[model samples]
Target: MPDRHVTRSGDDYAEAFSLLLPQGQAWPRDEGSTLMKVVRGLSQIWGVVETSASKLLEIESDPRITIDLLPDWERNWGLPDPCYKEPLTIDDRQRALVQRMTIEGAQSREFFISAAAYIGYSITITEYRPFMVGLDRCGDSRVYGDGTEPMYSDTFVVGSIPVCNPNGDPVALDELSEWPNYGLGPDTIRHYWTVHVHQARLTWFRCSGGQCGVDPHLRIGLATDLECLLRRWKPAHTEIIFDYSGLTPGDPMAGTP
Candidate 1:
């Protein structure tokens, strides 16, 4: 997910795709689009979902230490903060839903439990950590109908949580130029995909037990721990968003005429 860069491939060719719907497509209006809708539209090919509970284990108490650790933890990772604004406060329903998800996700893996506990321990000592992390959805658009069909493919990363400003100053069509394209395809019409997701990171640490506990190599241990967890956890696709409105709800994907 951190690898958002478009790399050149065979014969210096590269491409990406996106799905956009014309106005007047059908779907009921709500406060906003549901998380299920966004998650379902992603490509089914390859994705990495490192839950908040899993990451919670890597942090420790002490704001000073975490502040110091931030730069190092993020070394070589160029995660862009395109919004340049603070997180909007999610309503109680959303908060409860997120907490329930983290808890249930931890139940599936002991490592996630350990990670969640570690974050809980750190939160008792510090204030900057988030309660949840990494709510994302991505799918392979190159194939369709349970991935049996093959076509051009593309990948996208959600930059931030979806926010609605019903009364805030309207962002003009040209104003959206600043946001990075999902980089779907060279021809721009060969394939289509869409994504909207949220992510957070907390820090904590513990032990794996065994030998070398006396002078354990922290970095190596951490790497090994993450690798093992990734191997065992695989997310199953549970939903899909069809119909053109999924590409852009409430408004035509093409924007104002």
Candidate 2:
């Protein structure tokens, strides 16, 4: 399997991770087919990134940076926005529709590149270098870079889905105004949201930790275990620490070395 590993270290912490994709996953020959891959990747990637990064703001959709690569056919019919709080249910027909749309969107160079950047960046603020093609390099290209399939060597299968506590209802946007700032009790800041992916055909967990509606320390442990669980399928970079030795106002929560 073709794979790469990333390691990050700073004052308070140090960790290593990797992303494993099957070796040389080929692109489909048909133009339409390729586009479908893009769509699926986009939706799955968006769903995951949004759920993982929601602690920054209480909003489900961040207007500043978001991408959807749905095809015209699917778009015309109307597509459901991926929401953290909402459960996604699709019948066989709806599943097929989404599958087709995802493939088409994946094939589009602009969409693919943009989605990659967004997901990669959202993973962590830590510096990461994944095998990515820049948009400028793909400028004006009617088709994707040569019909060659990207090489991938490793894959991970999610063993089980994370179960959220039913008692924890989703925090609505309207409630944000009344929501306490500064810091609410750990229980109030933390909640679990699950995301289901079609390609991997797996359900994964996102534990809100660190200023979460729950306990920060518990969140860190869950996040760590989640990363370890993902390692069962593929290599992934996790737990990034920022270096601020020279800065006057360092992260107080980061802890002293």
Candidate 3:
């Protein structure tokens, strides 16, 4: 187990405390408030970051993986308009990897890395909200107002599918020429709809974790832990303060620090 201690005193402390307050509201003085209890529970779990990082480090002596916190449009499937066709499918191995990493205890470094890769891919796919339009074409039919008008379309909408390679160079989509034939006219149109539907499915899997019964918070927490580990593994010059020196208890709306 790594250092299960969270350094309190600055922004880290303030931010954690802030989580207890409602948006635009100040932290309540009463310690018995429900929000305070929730905050306390979260604070206790701050050790989770250390525990997770330790597990990851154990699996890989030099555990360092690059994650695009701010992926570009091309990397994220060109959201709002993808160029590929076909739904992205997570292989059985990858699904299992996510499950293992999301478990309540320490997990393999491979599992953590795979889960991060999948999450990175999923995040990119989810950015393109139009994927659902493509899925609607292949699945059931639907109607809007009065349930009379059919929303089905002959052409399939297309989007990007993220492919996580063994080398860690995950791509949103493969070569456009490699897409499967959907028996639809014009390769371009088919590609368009496939990308759209694929993104929608990927989004769902990312959010639901593919029925692995893993809590969303766990995944998010693990990711955060991994990021911290990576940063420490490879020293950087970034300056991040954990200080909360002048913060006072008052309504945030009133501009109280």
lDDT of 1 by residue, 1-257 (tens): 23233322321210111123323435322324553244334422222222222223333121122322333332323211222132211121122223333543431223333442322210011001122223312432221212211211122233432211111122232232112222333433212222111111222122321124333222111122222332333233212111222221222221110
Better of 1 and 3 by lDDT: 3
> Worst lDDT window (10 residues) for model 1?
121-130
Candidate 2 ranges with C-alpha deviation above 4 Å: 1-201, 209-257
What CA RMSD would you report for each candidate? 33.4, 31.7, 24.3
Report the poorest 10 consecutive residues by lDDT, candidate 3. 193-202
Q: How do the residues 34-106 of candidate 2 rate in per-residue lDDT, one tens digit apiece?
A: 5444544444544455444552233223222222222333465454432112232222124334433454443
Candidate 1: C-alpha lDDT: 0.25
Better of 1 and 2 by TM-score: 1
Those runs of model 3 whose alpha carbons end farther than 4 Å from true positions after fitting are 1-15, 19-26, 43-46, 58-257
The C-alpha local distance difference test score for the whole of candidate 3 amounts to 0.32
**Residue-level lDDT for 220 in candidate 3:** 17
